[model samples]
Target chain A: MSAPSSPVPAPLGSRVPLAGLAVALGALAFAVLPLLVPTYQVSILTEILIFAVLAMAVDVLAGFTGRTPLCHGAIFGVATYVVVYWSQQGGAPVTGVLLAVAAATLVAAIFGLLAIRTSGVYFLLLTLALGMIVWGVCLRWTSVTGGENGLRGTVRPELLAGHLPFYYAVFAVVGIITCVMWRFVRSPFGLTLRGIRDSESRMRALGYNVSLHLFLAFTISGFFAGLAGALYAMFNDFVSPSTVALSQSVEGLLMAITGGIGTLFGAFIGAAAIIGLENFVSQYTERWQSVLGLMFILIMIFAPQGVIGRVRDLLTRRR
Target chain B: MDRRTFLKTSVAAAAAGAVAMPHVARAQGGPIRIGLMAPLTGVVAAGGREMVDGFNMYWEEHGNEVAGRKVEVIVEDDAANPDTALQKARRLVEQANVSMLFGNLLANTGLAVANYVKGNGMPYFIPIIAADDLTQRNRIKNVIRVAGYTASQFPRPLADWALKQGYKKVATISQDYTFGHEQCGGFCQTFTEGGGKVLGQFWHPLNTSDFSPYLGQLANLGADVVFAMETGADATRLMQQYANFGLKGQIPLIGAMNMTDQSVIRTMGDEVDGVVVAAHFAEGSPAPVTQSFVAAYGKKFGKLPSLYGFSMYSGAMWVDEALKSIKGNAEDRDAFLASVMKTDLTGSPLGQTVKMDDYGNPIYDVHIRKVVKNKDGKYWNEPIANYPNVSQFWKYDPVTYMKQPPYSRDFQGIKKS
Candidate 1:
C-alpha cells in the first residue's frame, strides 16, 4: 500500500547502513530509558512497549494483508487469561508462556477459518462478533475468569520481579519479537500476502492460495499478539475482563492507525503517543479524553496515512 | 555588565535555586497528599463526580487541614478501566508521591488497585467499591474499606425482611458481574434459609438498555415478589422498563444497594415510589447528623447527597479522625494505617457509630429503605427499617463464612426441589 507513495526507492547501499544505525540508536535509548525516568514512568514505558507489539500484530493484518482482524484483542486477551490461569495453578513462567502462545494461536486459527472466508465489512463484523464471544466468556465464566473482578494473584517470577529488571526483560523480549516480525513481513510469503491484498484474483491466477496465505498471516499476527498479552499479564500481574473488552481491540487498532499502519516501527511511536497522552495529559487537565480525541482528529486530518507515513513521505520528498 | 557575565550569573543563580528547592520543601513539612482514583469519565462519571464532591466537601469544611498539616488531594481518572486504574495508581504513588490512596467506583478497578497497592504497601481506603473478596478471601493488609460495604452486605438484611413480609417465592434479576452475583447470592442464601424459595434468577449485562426480555421471563415466574440488584443508570432503565411493562405494581420490587440511590432516583418518576431497597445510608433519614449533611450538601452542591457522595464524605471524616489520632504524621505509614484500623467513629453521618471489623471493612447500620416523594417534590430513600451494627458476614461467624466460597452465580443458588 505504501509502495506507490515511494516512486523511487533509496539505493540499498545507503539504506542498509541508515536502517542499522537507526535500530542501534533506538535500542540504546530504550535500554537507558528506565535509568533516566522516574520509577513509575519506567512501568509506563514497559506498558507502551508491550502494547506496541500488539499494535504491530494489528498492522500485520490491517497493513500488509489488507484485512483488519478485530479479534486480535481477544487473541491477546486469551493469552493473558491463559498465562494468569496457568501461573495461578503453579505453572512456571516459561511453561505458562508456551500455553499462552498455543492457546492464542489456536483461537486465532479458528477465528481465521471463520472470518477469512469473508472480506471487507463482513470480515470486520465476523471478527468483532468472535471477539465479543471471547469477552462474554471471560465475563460469564466466573469459575475461571473470576467474572468482573477478574483473576488476580499471579506473582512475577523472582528473576524479573523488580521494576528495573522487569523493564529490561520486557525490553529484550519485545526487541527480539520485533526483529522476527520485521523478517516475517519482508519474507516471500509476506510479499504474496500483500499481493493477494492488492489483487486477490491476480494472486489466485498466479497460483497463490489466497485464503491459505491470509490465514497464515492472521495466525502469525495472533502469535505476536499473544506474546504481547503474556508480557502484559506479567507486567501488571493481574488480568480482568477489561483486557478482553471491545475497547481494548479498538485501542490497538487506533495505535496502529496513529503510528502509520504498515510501518512496523510506527507501532511503537503510536503506543508511546497514546500511553503518554493518557498518563501525562490527564495530570494537567480533567478533559484529557477530549484532548486525546482532538489530537486524534488532527492526526487523522493532517496525516491520513499516519505519523510515520507522513514522516516517510517528507523524507523521500526531500531526497 | 557584559552580556556573557550577565547570562552566566543568571544561570548560576537559577541552578542554585533549583538545588535548594528540595531542602526548602522539607523544612515546610509537605502537605499530606491523598491520591484519589475514580471513573471521572465514561459510564460512571456521575457517581465518580459525586464521590469526589463528597470527599472534598468534608476536607473543605475542615479547611483542608488535618492535625496541623495541609491536605492535598490528587484526583486521577481511571476511565473505569483496570489497566488505566493500575497506571493511574502507580502515577499517584510513585510519581505524585501521595501519602495514601483513596477512591475506586467499580469492582474491577477496585481489585486492580488493591492488587497493585498490596505490592507497594500503600494504605488504600476504598470508599465505593463493593467487591466481596477484598474483605473476605483475599484481604490485603494495607487495604482498608472505610466507607465501603461488600456486595452482599446490604442485601442480607433485606432477605430476612422479605421472608418476614410473607414473600415465600421470589424471582431475582441483577447485573451479571461480581457485585450482582454476590448481591443475589446473599439474598438467596438468607431467603432460602428462612424457608423462602427463589423461583428464578436472571442475570443481565451491565449498561443493558432493555429489560423487556428479562421482564418477560419475570412475568411468567408467578413469584411472590421480584428482587432487583442494579445501580446508576442501569437502575433507572430497569425501573422505567418495569413500569413500562406494568410489572411495578404487580410484583413488589426490592432493590439492592443504590438501586434507587438519590443520584439515580431523582431521574426516575413516580413508578419508583414505595419500592423497598436496603443500603448503608438513607438520604432522607431524619437523624440530626444526616439532616445536617443533607442541608449542607444541598446548599453547596444544589442536590441531595447520593450514597456515593455520603460514602466518600464519611470516608474523608474517617481519614481525618485517623489522622488526628496520629497527630497528622501521615508520613509514618505504619502508624497511619494502624490508626485507621483502630477507628471507632461515633456519631458519624450514618446516625450510628461506625466501627472497623477485623478484615479491614466497616461495621455499620444497614437501613431497609422505601422510595418516597418528599414535600419538596424530590424522591428520597426513607428509612423504613434499620438493621443495627451489620457486618459483611451477616449472621454467620466470620470463620464459617470464610470457609464457604466467595459468592458466585451458582455457589449460593437455590436448591432445586
Candidate 2:
C-alpha cells in the first residue's frame, strides 16, 4: 500500500533502573506511612494505592497505546463486585480478587475489540458508553448490586497481619504490576502500539493488525484496572455503582495527567498528592470537593504533565 | 540491615502494634460506646458538627458517663455519601469497637449503617435522619430508630395543615430519592385521606443545583399550597428558586422540616416566612425542653441548631440511657444489642416519648410546625399544632413495611402505585 511503515522497535528488556527504584521507594514509604500518619490517613493512603493501580492502567491505554479506554472505572467496579460476590459465596478473598481482574481482562478484551473499529473521539465515546452501561447495570440490578443502598463493604481480612503488613502486600503487588507494565511499554509490542497511535492507517497498509494490537493493549490495561478494583473492594469491604461512575473514570484520567501519563511512577505520585491533598483539604474546608476540583483544573493548566512527568520533561528538555 | 538492627526495628514495630491493638480492644469497652457516624466534614459538616456538639452536651450534662463507664462518643464522618457511610460502619465496628452505633445525620448514611449494622448485630438506633424506608421496609434487625419515619407523618400532617389553611389544591416537589419519595408518600396519604388533591408533582436529581424548572412547574400548577421535601444546600437553593417564581407569597407552602431547617430558613430569608413544615421538633417548639436545648445549643455553637443536632443528641442519649437499663457488661454484644433492641420505650428531651416497635421505628408523635416572625426579626419555627400520636399507618407493622422493597414503599399519604 504505498510507503513502508516504520519497523517495529526491539524490546528494551535488559534494565529499567527507574522502575526498580520507584518500587524500592514505594516499599519504604509503605513501611513508614502507617507509623507517621494516623489510622485515617493510612486508610486514605491504602485507597490512593488502589486508585494509583487503576490510574496506571488508564495511563497504559491512554499514554502507551494512545487509544483512551475510559471504561476502566466500570471494569474495575465489575471486578470489585465479582470479588464481593465471591467473598459472600465463601470464596477465598484473594481468589475472588484475582478472579475480578481475570473477568475484567475478558470484559476489556471484548470491549476493546468492539471499540477498535472506531478511532480517536469515537473510541473515547465507546469507552464512556461502556462505562455508563456498567453503571446502569449496577444501579438497576439492585437485587445483586444493592442499588443505591450499597453493599456493606466489611473490614478486609488483613493478609499478612494488620495495617503495616497490608501496606507491604499492596506495595509488592503494585511494584510487580508496575515492573511488568514498564517492560511492556518499552517492548516491541509497546512500540507497535505507539506506531499505531501515531499512524494506524500506515500500520494497516504494512500488514500489521491494528485492531489486534489495540485490543491487546486495552485488555492488559483492563487487567490492571480489575486488579485495582478487586484490591479496593477487599480493602474497603464494599462495592457500589458510584465507584464505577463516569466521575471516577474522569478522576482516573486526572490522576494520570496529574502524575505525568507517560511515566511509570506518575500514577503513584498523583494518587499520593491527590489523596493527601483531599485529606488535608477536607479537614480545613467543607467545600473540599470543589477545592480539589479547582486543584485538578490548576494542575491541568499549570502542571499538565503531572508533578513527576513535568519534572522529568523539564530536566530532559533542558539537557 | 544487620541482624541486631533488624531485630531492634522488628521489636519496635511489634511494640507499636501492641500499643495499637489495645485501642482496637478498648473500643469493645466497659463503657457504653456510642458511635456517631455523620457527614462531619462535607457541606452539611456544619450541621453535623452542631449535632455532635448537642450530643456531647447531652453526654456532658449526664456526667458523660453511661453504663458506669466514661461514655466514649466515637465521632466519624459518613461524608453525606453512602459509600463513606459503609466504610465508616466497618471502621466503627472493627476499630472503634463501639457497643452501640447511633446518630446518622444523612438519609443515605442512615440507610447504609442500618444495612451494615444488621451484620455487625449492633443495635444501630437512628433518630435524626428520616429516611422512611430505614424504619419502614428496610428495617434491619438489631437497628432501632427514635426519629419519625418519612412515611408516618408525611403528606398527611402537612396536607391537613394545608387543608386547614383552606388550600384545597396542592403541588409536590422533592429530591428524587428514597427519603423524598417517602416524605411525599406520607404527605399524600394524609392529604388524600381528608379529600385534598395534589395538583402538581415534580422530581429533581439529588446533585441538581438548579430548581428553576421544578419551581416553575409547581408555580404553573396554580395550587393553593406547595408541599415539598428538599434538604441542605438543595433546600436553600430550591426555596430561593421558589421565591423567584413568586410562589412563596402567592401560594401557601408546607413541607417536611428537612425541606427547610434552621439553615434553610436562615439562608432562604423572606421566603421562609409563612412556610408550614411538619416535624418532630422546631426551633421555637413550645416545650420547655426544646427551649433549653435551643438555649444550650446556641450558647455552645452561637447559631440556631438544626434538627440533625436534635436527632443526633437524642440518638446518642437513647443509646447511652438504654445501656443504663440493661446494667449488663457494656461490651457484651448479646447483652448490649439486646438492651438497645428493648428500646421500645423512649422518654427523651424532644417533647414526645419515642416508642420503637420490633422493627426499630418510633411509634410516637409527629408535629405540624410553621415559620412565623418572632421578636428576634429572624423567622423562627413555631409549633402551631401537634399530632401527639401520629405515626406512619404502617408504624405498628414495621416488619411488614421493612419487608417491602424500598422503592415500592411510600409515605403514609403518598401513593405506592
Candidate 3:
C-alpha cells in the first residue's frame, strides 16, 4: 500500500483555539446543567455523559483505528456487574471501582487480541460473538449476576448517592477523560493511529508495529468504556444483562457514526440526540422509536458529517 | 427580517410559549395521575396489550373518574426489561409526578419497581407478577400485591388434589427462571411430602422452541402425571410439540394457569384437552361476576380476557374501591395505603371477594381448572377444584418458610431418570 503523494494536513491554526473554546464552554454548561434543570433532565444528562464516553470509545476504534468492535458494550457491562456484585457482597467502594475498571480492561484486551487478527466485518462478527458470550453469562449465572432479573440495590456511598452529586461526579470524570483523549488524539501516537487508518502497510513499512498499536488503541477504548459502565451501575443503582447485549454495542457504534465518524465532540452530540429521543421524545408519543429512526435517517441523508461535524464545518466555511 | 429568520423566530417563540402553557393549565385543573409501566413491546406485547385493556376497561365503565376526582393514567412501555422498567418508573414518579403507580407484567420487573417505589415511599399495586419474594423476604410496606398468589401458591392446591386423585408419581417440566423454579418447587415439595413417588424433572430454557428433546426424557421417566409450568407462547409451543409427539392425552398434563390461558388454549385448539392447571381466575365459573366480566372483556378487546387481563382489571377495581373509601385522597400516602389495605374487591373481575393479607399480599381464591371444549367448540379452563383465602405461604408459618432458600434451577431434591 502506498501513502498519498500529498498527505492530508493535520487540523491546526484558528480552528484549534475555537474548538478548545467550544469544548470549555460545553464543559461549563454540563457542570451547571444539573443545578439549573429539573431532576429528570439531570438524570437524562448524566446518562448522556456516560454514554458519550462509550460512544467516544467507539469513535476511537471505528474512526481512528478503522475497526468496529462490537464487544465494547460487553466490556462496559462486565465492569458494571463486577463492581455491582462486589459492592453488593460487601466490597469497599474504591476497591470495587478499581476491580471493575481492571476487569473491563482485561476483557477488552482479550476481545481485542481475538479481533485485532481480523479486519473489517470479521472483527465486528468476532466481537459480537464475544459480546453474546458475556450476555449469556450475565443471564445464566444467576448466582452472581442475578440472571435475567439483574443485580439491583447496589450500595453507593453517601457521597455519590444523590442525583445532583452523582451527575457532577460523572461530569467531572468524563470531562477530565475527554481532555486526556483530546490530547492523546492530537499527539504523535494519535497521528500514527490515523496513519494506520489511512494505510496500514505503509505505516508497518515505516517501522510502526500496526497490530500492537491497534491492540493498545482497543485496550484504551475498553478502559474508558469500562469507566462509563462502572459509573452507570452506580448511577442506576442496578446492573442487567441487557447492558452486555449486542444492542448496546450497536447503540455505541450508531452514536459514533451519527455524531460524525472521526469527530470526538460528535460522540457527545450523538449520545445527547439518542438519549434525548428515548427520554424526552417518548414522553410525547408512543411511536418514539419510529420517530428516532426517522431522525437518524434524516441526519444520515442531510447532515452526513454528523450534527457537530456539520456545524463545525459550516462555521469554518463561513469564516 | 428575511423569510427564513422570521420563520425561525416565530417557531422558536411558539415552542417556548407551548412549553410555558402546560404548567398554567395544570395548576388550574388536573386529574389525579396514575402511572403504569408494562412490557407494551417486544415478545410480551400481547400480554401487555391485554393488561392495558383491562386497566382501561374499568376507567371507561366509570367515566374515567374515581369518586369526585378525574383519573388519568399515563402508560409507559418498559420493554419487559428490569432496567427500563425502573427508568420508566422514575420518569413516572419523579418527572410526571404521578400520585400512584400500578401494573408490571414480569416478576423481575415487579421486584425492580417494588424497590423503586419502596425507596420513594409511593403506593404501588402489583396485579400480575406472582414471584414469592415480592411478598416474602423482599416485601415492602408500600407495595400492595393485589392478586397475591405467588408461583408457589399456584401449585400447592394442585399437588393436594393430585394426592387426592392417587397420582403417586410426579414429573415436572418448567421454565428455567424465578417464576418456574418456585412453581415446580412448590409442586414437587408438596407432592413428595404427600407420599408421591419421585420422578424426573426437566427445567427448560424460557424460549425453548423444541420441547421434543425434553418430552423424550419425560416419556422415559413414565411418571403418573407431569406438573408443567410453561407460560405464554412457550406453553402453546410445548403443548403443540407434546401433541405432535403423541404425549398430549397419553400423559395427564397438569400445569400452572399459564399453560391453559384462554389465548393459549385457543391457539392450541383441541390438542390441550383435559390439561389441568391451577389459577386464581377461570372462564366457566358459576359466579355472575365472572360471566359478566367474560362478556364485557370480550366485547371490548374482541378476545377472551386471560388471567393477566383479569388481574389487571381487578387491580383497577381494587384501586377504585380504595380511592373511593378515602374519598379520592391520594396525597397522604399513609392514609392511601391504609385504605388500600382495607380494600375488599368484591364483585370485581375475579368473581370473588378478596382482601390483603397481613404481609400486603392477597388472600383470594385459587382455582384448579381443566381445559375443556365448550358448546361453541371454544376451549376454556373449567374449574375442577377451588382453594379459598389462600395466602402466599399457604398454611405454613411465614418464618419457617422464609428460612428455606427460594427455589432456583438447581435444587438438589429432584430425581433424574
Candidate 4:
C-alpha cells in the first residue's frame, strides 16, 4: 500500500518544532518512566536506546546510500566485544572503541565493495553469509571469545551504579546522534548521496564518485554501528556473537521497517514499537514471537510502510 | 496514495499499531504451575530440547499439580538469547499465570528474567546456566537456582591438575565474553590460590573463525595444562585446535565448564576423550535415581544423557519432588516459596545430596570428569572424583549469595526461610 504522504504542507523547518516537541515529550516520558514503571520497563528502555542507535545506522546505509546491507549488526557487535576485550588487556576503552569502530568501518567497506558487485538478493545473501560466518566463528572459537559463555561484565562507573544516570546517558547519546543524522540528511553531501541512492549511474554521469560515495556511506554507517556496539558493550557489560548473528541483523531490519525506513524518528519509533510490543507481549504470553510474527505479517500485508508511515498518512488525511 | 501521502500514510498506519488495552494473565490451576523457558530451537536445539524433555519427564512421573490443580509446564523457547528468554518468561508468569517460572541457560538471560520475576513477586527457578554471580552478587528474591553454579565447579580441579602437572606461569584464552571471562577468572583465582602463577590471558571474539593467533600465543605462553572454557560448537572447535597444536596430550588441557560438556562430546566425537574438566554430575553419578534416569533415557532415546541433560532431568524431578513434599500448598505463594527455599533432595543424578545454601546455589559435590569412549563407541564424560559437600560460592560468604544483584539486598527469596 502506498504511504500517506500529504506534502508535509509544513516545510521541514516548521515541522522541526513539532518533531522537537514530540522528542521532548518522549524524553520526558522516559525520565518519568522509572518512577511509574517497573524495573523490567527500565531494562526494556535500555534495550530501546541501544537499538535506536543501530536502526539509525541502517538508515544511513539503506535510506541514504540506497544499498541494502544485512551484516551491519555483525560489524557493530564484533567491534563492541573486541573493543571491550582489548580494553581489558590494558587497552583504553575509548581508544578500543574507536579502533574497533575504525576496523569495523574498514571491514564493512571492504565487504560492501565486494558485495556491491552484485545487487538485490545476491547482495543480501552475501551479507547474510558473512553474518552467519561470524556467528559460527563466535560459537566455535572458544579460547579467545569465551566461547558461548559470552563476554560479561559490569559497564558501570561510580555514576552508572544507579539506573537514572545510565538511562539519561543513553538518551543523550542517541538524541545527539539523531540530531547529527538529521543534519547529515539535510546536508549537500546527504542530498548528493540521496541523489546517488536514487540513480547511481546518473549521479556518476553528473561527476559523482559513485563507488567512493558508496564506500564512504558504508564506512559512516559502520562507524555508527560500531558506536552502537561500543555503547551496548558498556551498557550490558557483555557481548556475544548472538548480537551479530543473522537473526539479530534481521531484527535491526525489522525495527527499521516496522517504524518506517526513511524517517529518522521512525527508526527509534520502530524500535520503541517492537521493543515495547515485545515487553508487553512477553508479559502476557510465552508464544509472543508467534504474536510478533503475526503482527509483522499484518503490517506487511496492510501497512507496508509500518506504524509510523500509517500514522503520518492518517494525520495528513484528516487535515 | 502518491509518494508523499504513501510515506505519510505508512507513518500514520504504523502509529495505529499502538496497543489498545494492556493485557493481563490471571492465575489458573496451580500444580506449582511453573513456566519452563529454555532454548527449544536453534544452534543449541539438541541440548535445549533434551533439557526440556528431561523437565517434562520428571513432571510426568512426580508432579502433583499445585493445590490439587493439574500442574502445567509452559515450555517456551528462549532461543538462547536474552530478549526472547525475557519475553517467554513474561508469558508464563502473566499470560499462563504460572505460580513459578523456570529455565534460563545463558547468564544474561538468567539475570534478566530472574530480576523481572522477582520484581513481580513470582518465584523463578533456574535448572541450568550456572554463572557464579547469579547466586553470589546478583541473587534475587523469588529466584531459586537448583543447579550448581558452573564457576564454582572449576577451581579445585583446575588447581589440583595444575599443581599435579607441576605447571606454573599459566595463561588462559577464553571466548571474549562474560561466561568465559568470569569462569576463567575463577580458574586463575583457584590456580593462584594453589600457588600457581598466571602468565597472561587472551579472549577472542565469540564468533571468530580463525584461531591461529590464539593457538600461536598459547604455544608462546608455555603454560602447562592450558585451561579452556567453551561450550557447544565453540568447544568442539577449540578441542580440534588443541589436538591440532599437539597440546591436548602434551599441555594437559583442563576445561571446567564447556570442554567436557555434552555438546563437546557430540560435536567432536573421538577427540573428546582425555579432555578433563570439573563438573559435579555425570551419567555415572551412581545413585539409583541417576541409574534409572540413564536407563530410561537410554531405553527411550537410545543413549545416555549428558551432564547437562542429566542435571536438567534431576532438576525437573527435584522440582516435582519438592512440589510433592509441599503437596497442594505450593499454590500458596509464600508457603510454596518457603518450601522451595528449603529444598534438600538426594538420590538424584548427581548422586550427592543437594541442599539449598543460604543462597540458591547448590552446596554439593564437585566432580572432575574426563571424556572417555564408552562401550557404544561414543564419547561420554565420566566422573573421576567427587569433591563432596563443597560450597559452590567460595568467594562470597553464605550470607551474600542469597541477596545479590539482579535484585536488591534483603530480598526475601534468599532470606533463609
- Chain B TM-score list for all models: 0.93, 0.85, 0.92, 0.84
Q: A29-103 in candidate 1: lDDT tens per residue?
A: 778867866678788889989999999999988887888778888899999999988888898988998999999
Flag regions of model 1 displaced more than 4 Å.
A1-14, B1-28, B413-417
Cα lDDT tens digits for candidate 2, A27-59: 686667677754545666677888899989988
Going through the candidates in order, their DockQ values are 0.43, 0.16, 0.38, 0.13
Q: Write the per-residue lDDT of candidate 3 for residues B249-306, one digit (tens) a residue.
A: 7878888888888767766676788999888889877678888989888887777788
Docking class of 4: incorrect
lDDT of 4 by residue, B351-388 (tens): 66788877676776777777788676777777776666
**How many clashes in candidate 4?**
66
Q: Quote the positional error of residue B281 for candidate 1 in Å.
A: 1.0
Ranking by TM-score, best first?
Answer: 3, 1, 2, 4
Better of 1 and 3 by lDDT: 1
Each prediction's Cα lDDT score?
A: 0.86, 0.70, 0.81, 0.68
Interface RMSD for each candidate model? 7.5, 8.6, 5.8, 8.1
The CA lDDT at A66 in model 2 is 69
Span of 10 residues, lowest total lDDT, candidate 2 chain B: B16-25
lDDT: worst 10-residue window of model 4 chain A: A1-10
Off by over 4 Å in 3: A1-9, A315-319, B1-30, B412-417
